[model samples]
Target: MKISNRSTSTGRRRTSAAVALGAVLALTATACGDDGSGGGEGAEGSGKGKIVFWDNNGGVRTDIWKEIIADFEKANPDIDVQYVGIASTEYQSKVDTAIQGGGLPDVGGVGAAMLAGFAAQNALEPLDGRLAKSSLNGKLNKDMIESLKAAGGGDDKLYSIPTSANNGVLYYRTDLFKKAGLAEPTTWENFYKAAEKLTDKSKNAFGYTIRGGAGSIAQALDAMYGQSGITSFWDSSGEKTTVNDPKNVAALEKYAGLYKKVTPAADLNNDFTKMVAQWDSGTIGMLNHNLGSYQDHVKALGVDKFRGVPQPTGPGGRRVQVSNPVDGLGLFKSSKNKEAAWKFIEFALSHEVNSRFNESAGQVPANLEAAKDPWIEKAEPTKLAARALSDGSTSIVQLPYYLPDWNTISKADNEPNFQKVLLGKLSAKDFLDKMAEQLNEAQKEWKQQNG
Candidate 1:
């Protein structure tokens, strides 16, 4: 399934080099149909009355999706849903190729990170009109709907519907905190002090774990906002980059300084899996991850050992966290069976089906009613996150999700520079400056192209 708040992987090592190569392939590869024509088999209006649906995380969530598809098909005897599962890492490349080469699926999983890119290519069908007439109109979360619209170039048109959300959390060892006489880390100042006090270098114990590989940018961004007090990723009109703001630079510097003091040197190359494994197996005081890793943490260190809290706050006393990356489903523009596909989408999003899916996936369902499911109510992380979101104590820093080059800049380019910062080879100012420059250029180009 699409893991929230972090990149989905099979606990494999995802180095910067590997990710760069994948980004290169995704960008450089070309296919026919630049004019948005379906030139080959399974092209628009070409499928033989069968609904071909693709699962973004093929092997990871194939069985679960297959079960859902089976239920859909069984309920509608006349329609046959063809299932195809694609790995998360390769899904974007495959979809990009399909958009240009033909043979797009009727409906498929689309990540928040990739939504703008795909929508910009004119590959997705707008679903705002269809959603208004369906049962999902009042059921889906309103904030999430706004998020989808902002991601879709802020045109007030939704190209995809949110399926679930993963919120940022700080998981800490309760026993260790009690032993150290430290209060729960509720603020950045307290968290830093606790990290310092918890570190026992001779015992190989650390205060926190850092993610320097693959998905480092998001974690760093969260830390930056928590310390900086900046609330948005761009200016009012979305024409500037805020990465290099003085406040943000100070935040990044402070965050990077935690390395070699409260964190292990080995953390410089750790991905989420390796970092989570380290925290799970060792005497770590706190770990930064999302709700997606909740199950893994619970499986490793039972419920009594640790507790998950929302990300810490800054001096302003507000918990400033970035919006959790969303997982969504989009309708392809080329699909001829739009009506039947909408039926399937509506069915999957029904209260009961939505509850079942999120319960199995261990994420907060996008359906507002599904959030009240007993399974979610019993889960500590979900409950705490819901409180944080609704209590008005947490401020979500909405990034410019409409930026099509976000994946390339954030993942492929920003990761290696972050690694350099951790290694002391690059200064935080330099890193943010370079990142801001690249993003500014991208923002200008996007305006020129779209306007």
Candidate 2:
């Protein structure tokens, strides 16, 4: 369920490597078409007559995507569907190379985090008009559709169609909460109290598991917004970063202080996988992760032992949580077989097919009807997420998705600085200041280049 491009634990090891890759990507930006035009010379019009589709997460969703492709081909006997599954870790790099080298796929999976970058390069074919004429226009989730539009630079144009959405949830042990005479962690006040009460250093038990390694920034940002009540990653005008705002700094300090006392020392180096494994096998009280890890928790601890709930609300009695990175499919402008490729996308997003895919992936489907499947109805996490979204008290803190350098800043550059905050080597203010400095520079540069 993890999109390799968004999650750090997927194999992004060194910051130096990421910096090097960022440099290469920056240099190749012009190669991806800077004038909002289609791709390279030969990239125009998919003349091959074959639909070359790329599945972002090769091994994880290869079989399911292949099955969907098979169904699409069965429905259209004349169109040859070429399926190429690439691991999440390698997908972005490959796509960047293709955009520069003139071998882009006709259609491929694109996550919210990567949408702006691709759109900035003009590699994506705008889908708003196409979707309006398609059957999926009104059947898709409105929030996700809006989220995708925002991710594509807040334009009316749609660069991608949402396939599914993920959200942050706190999974807690029912038995442990009962034993401690504690209620569910619904508010930050109660959540922190529960963590403190559940931790027993002598017993090698902690309250929470911290993901200080790869992909830690997003979790930290969620905690900050949850406590600080901030609604957006950037301030009004989208030019200034509010990461180092006083309230955010206070919220971040409180979140990071839970490290040694409530979280284990080993958590300092733990990625999402390691953190989840520790929480599942050990005596942790609360684990914060996205819905993608729900199946893993169910497998490790029976469904009866634990429960997943939306993020705890802030002091204002409002739930301020950042939306987990939404994944979707984007059409390549260079493809000659655009119409045929659109047909396959339409087929894959049909209610039944979307239901089958989301069911296997254990995520909330983007198709409104597909979300009503029996599997989602029976899943507690999905039910809670649905309620949270519909309750009218939750606010999503949308990040600055329009910035092409967003992925680099949030993933690679911000991680080590966050780790410093956890290790107490850097203050929360300093961390946020550094992050804000980088983001502001990136934002300014993006405007100069893009506008």
Per-prediction TM-score:
0.84, 0.83
Off by over 4 Å in 2: 1-50, 76-90, 201-203, 236-238, 446-451
In model 2, the Cα lDDT at residue 420 comes to 90
Residue by residue across 1-451, what tens digits does model 1's lDDT show? 1111233222112332243244333333321212223432213343225677888768656766888889988888777888889876568777866765566777889877788767766677789888998878999988777788878864668888888887998999999999999999989988998899999999999999888877789899999988888888887878787878999999999999999889988888887777888999999999998886787778889999999999998866888988776888888876666666777788888888888877766678988888888999777987899899889998888766677667767776678889999888999999998888777876776577568
- Estimate the TM-score for candidate 2: 0.83
For each candidate, the alpha-carbon lDDT, in order, equals 0.78, 0.79
Candidate 1 lDDT (Cα, 0 to 1): 0.78
Assess the local accuracy of residue 320 in candidate 1 as a C-alpha lDDT between 0 and 100.
Answer: 90
